[model samples]
Target: MKMKIQFIVLPLITLLFIASSIAYAQNKNSAADNRNAIDRMTKELGLNETQRGKVEGILSAEQKKVEAVFNEERKKLQLIQEETRSNLQAVLTPEQMQKLENKMRQEGSKNNAQKK
Candidate 1:
């Protein structure tokens, strides 16, 4: 029924999402990278303190907006990930599930280490 379908689809979705996030992270331009653009503008334009302050305010506001959007998307992704894990438990054999859980834990730790 619906539950069986859910279990079968869950693993595929998880794999797809993991691959996509890896790709996205590799290609993404983070807000920190904006520092270079800001600096370049200041140098090329000879911005005075007043103009520089205005530019900083605009950039800061834009960065906040980007962060807000990222957070909203991340929340959705977390919900999907949780659902995937719950459904996968029903479909995978106990041994298979254990292997998957261990792999996920390893990857999680690796990601944390990389972040630092």
Candidate 2:
């Protein structure tokens, strides 16, 4: 039971950390980053209005694709996390599961506070 808990919880925590980091990065940069890239290209390559418009469209499409991919991956990760938690609940006693929930909540609060 202990080993199973460790195995499931460790990977779940790792996935959550990775997902949070990716979300934070996406929120921080976003569309402005795309516009900045286009601006840089326009300046460096001396692109005309038509070329600039095309590049903007390309960037916009790329951003949408990337966001879609991340969203899909995020949904998959969430499902995996939920499954792992359910499995853990099956393995653990009620008291142990409650303890685990409290620990996770505390950790989440710490993470949220740190982010602020």
Candidate 3:
């Protein structure tokens, strides 16, 4: 069970975490949050129309660049995780593989319940 967790459950959880992070990074609320931040900054600094516009542009560009990087990295992480699972499958016997799958499903269910 320990080895099953170390080899399978941990990686599965990591993949789930990374997937959720990617989803959050791509969430539309990020744009709204950015706008709110800029609005606060403009109010506090008494920025002129032109200054506010420039600041918004700068932040929007920065956010796009950061999101692109995050998406690219997330893809790489998923590929690595897939390869790890494949390799683990190759190493384990059929019975062990079934057990690992069952354990993974249990863990996934537990995580989902916790989230709810």
Candidate 4:
């Protein structure tokens, strides 16, 4: 019984986690990617110190904006997920919910490992 519930919920949670992360998961590489782009642009364009500073500022601002948008979206997603979980709590048995939660934790760890 437990294994059945866990198997089902594990995959569903994994899919949801992927879907949620899709909206704003690039921040981990954003800084490195942006820095590389800036470096390439600077070298190709031969930007002076003043121009470089302006360009860096522009890039930083853009990155910040992107981060902000994603953060906001993630928050909204989190709220929706919480509501869904709460609603499920009404339908699922406590034992089933415990198994589901454990499965989710195991999946979360697996996801984190892949990210690293």
By TM-score, how accurate is candidate 4? 0.75
Name model 2 segments beyond 4 Å from true: 1-4, 20-28, 106-116
RMSD in angstroms, all models?
A: 5.5, 2.9, 3.5, 3.3
For each candidate in turn, the TM-score is: 0.63, 0.75, 0.70, 0.75
Q: Candidate 3: lDDT of 4? A: 57
lDDT of 3 by residue, 1-116 (tens): 64755665567655665475546646646798899989999999999999999999999998898777777777777777678678767777778778766776776666667655
Give stretches of model 4 more than 4 Å off: 1-12, 19-25
The list of candidate 1 runs beyond 4 A from truth reads 1-32, 106-116
lDDT of 4 by residue, 32-81 (tens): 98889889988999988898889999999999999998888788778877
- Scored against the true structure, residue 1 in model 3 reaches a CA lDDT of 60
lDDT per model, in order?
0.68, 0.79, 0.74, 0.79
Which structure is stronger by lDDT: 2 or 3? 2
Which model, 1 or 4, shows the larger TM-score? 4
Tens digits of lDDT, candidate 2, 5-114 = 66668657665856766675794577999989999999999999999999999989988888877778778778887887788788888888787777777777666677
Backbone clashes in candidate 3 total 0
Candidate 1: the clashing residue pairs are: none
TM-score of 2: 0.75
